[model samples]
Structure formats: C-alpha cells, structure tokens
Target: GAGVSQSPSNKVTEKGKDVELRCDPISGHTALYWYRQSLGQGLEFLIYFQGNSAPDKSGLPSDRFSAERTGGSVSTLTIQRTQQEDSAVYLCASSLAMVTDTQYFGPGTRLTVL
Candidate 1:
C-alpha cells in the first residue's frame, strides 16, 4: 500500500489563528504518530495512537494541541491560537504495530505562523 500522506504541505497563518493538519496512514497500519520539528531541532513527539487503545498524548506541548484518529486510519492534528513559536514542520508516521516496527513518515506540513 501507499505510505502516509498529509494535506496542505505548506501553511502560513497569522498568530492567534488556528490550523488543522491531516494525515492518511498506510492501509492496515495500526499505529500513528505526530511529531513537530523546528529549525535546528530534533523531532518532538506530539501524539500517538495505537489500535483501539487510548492515545498517548503526554508529548503535546500544550492544551491547545490535540489530535484524533478516526476509523483507525486517518488522523488530524489541530493547533489552536497559533503563535510564532509554533512555526515548525509537522510530521506524521505510521507502522503496522507499536513495538519494534519501522515507522514510515509523511512529507510533513511546514507551518509558518507570522
């Protein structure tokens, strides 16, 4: 099947606005993850969903950041009241299962909050 895909590869928004990023994981994949990467920084884990289990959201930077996976396939990451510091590339990855599997990443959505 195809690899993960994300919509709106690039987004530029004013500070205080909100943005929603979408991801489509590979068919049959049961694990999904969202990460953020700022310039010169490593990828920061944001949220994760595995099968029917509760999502692990401890990595979310703030309450304004949230994500959900519907039908165990597609995922959306929403950032509320965006700030300049929120500027970064949002990456999505998925694997067949949660343990010891290679995660394939999407191209990433580059967000620039002005």
Candidate 2:
C-alpha cells in the first residue's frame, strides 16, 4: 500500500564525495526508473529496471553514476566523486509493467554537491 519513497530527502555533500540515494518502489510494480531533474532542466532519464531483465543504463550521464534494483523492489543510485554539476533532484518512479505504463513518482532526493 505504500507509494514510492526516497531517503534523506535533502543531501548536501562536498565535491568528490560519494553519495548513495535510496528508493523503495510500491509493491508489485514491474518497472522502476531513475531520473534526474537538474536546475532549470527537464527530467533526465538515468536508468530503468523491468522484472528480471538487465537494467537499461544508456541514459546515465557518465561512469560516475550507477544504480541497482534489488529483488525488483528497492533501488539505489550511487554517485561517485560527486561534482557540483551533479546537484539535482533524483526521482524514482514505478509502473505496473511496460515502459508506456503510467508511473508513480517519489518526492525525490535533492542532492547538492557543494
């Protein structure tokens, strides 16, 4: 019955530090996505996980970013060597099945790399 949720809603870290943002998707959802909303920018797709298949990571900006979905329910986005340019709101969404399906979003984790 719970909706998608992200932890440490606001994170402020120094440049070059590593940060891990967590997301818990709603139960029974088969598709999960990670998006980044930068200042004055649109939501940028980061990664997607559907069922047991390998994750789609083409949208990731660089090798500094990575993510994983455990048991098809929870996910974590890790940013290594955080940079000022990486500051943004990391949003997580889950859909019933396909990529075309409607997705429910979390409040997002606002990451500020100082």
Candidate 3:
C-alpha cells in the first residue's frame, strides 16, 4: 500500500463485544506500530514490531488487547470484551525504520462502545 490504511473508520458497538481493527502498512516498511488516542489524550503507544525482534507489547493496557504482524506486513488488533473505556481511535503507523526516521500514521479506526 502507499500508506497505512485502517479499516472501519468508525464502529459503534455495545460494551463487551469483541472487535478487530485492521491496518495495511506501506510497502517495504520495516517497522510497524499501533497506538491509541482517547477523546482528549495524546497518542499512546500500544505495540511495536521491527524486523524479527521480539515485539514490544508494553503499552497494552490489559489482557484483553492483542495484536500480531504476519509476513512483516499487515497487522491486526483484536480487543476482547470491549469496555466503555476502550472507546477511542486506534491508529497504526509505519516507517522505513522507526529506529531511524519518523513514522507515517493512518487515518485511524474510531471505536465507540456504549
């Protein structure tokens, strides 16, 4: 892809339902990341994957959140039993190498729980 593409730009669901957000990163990118942004909060790092290294999953808030990258390309984020507090925009970013340059972000998937 030319840029990071996030699916379901907007989603509305009842609390406790599982939701999966997809991200298609730019071609030839070696670093991929997931982030969260609440109503008024700054971007929060969720996870990062670079090359074949161990993924950095330190930012996931709870056990209900999980993500994975396949073939070092596309990635998916799955939230299980979503909560009201989980309502926010899920952003995915990619770079030729996050360790060296800046990241390019996607439009983001907006998830709303009621």
Please name the candidate that would achieve the greatest lDDT relative to the true structure. 1
In terms of TM-score, the best-performing candidate is 1
lDDT of 2 by residue, 6-104 (tens): 997999999999999999988999899999999999999999999999999999999999999988889999999999999999999999997579999
Comparing candidate 1 with candidate 2, which one achieves the higher TM-score?
1
Runs in model 1 lying further than 4 Å from the true structure: none
Q: How well is each residue in 11-71 modelled by candidate 1, as lDDT tens digits?
A: 9999999999999999999999999999999999999999999999999999999999999
TM values, all candidates: 0.98, 0.97, 0.96
Q: Please provide, for model 3 over 4-101, each residue's C-alpha lDDT reduced to its tens digit, 9 standing for 90 to 100.
A: 89998999989999999999999988899999999999999999999777889999999999999988998999999999999999999999987777
How accurate locally is residue 69 in candidate 2, as Cα lDDT from 0 to 100?
A: 90
Q: In model 3, which residue pairs have backbone atoms overlapping below 3 Å?
A: none
lDDT (C-alpha, whole model) for all candidates: 0.96, 0.95, 0.94
Q: In candidate 1, where is summed lDDT lowest over 10 consecutive residues?
A: 1-10
Task: Give the lDDT of residue 60 in candidate 3.
Answer: 97
Error of 3 at 60 (Å): 0.4
CA displacement after TM-score superposition, residue 27 of candidate 3 (Å): 0.2
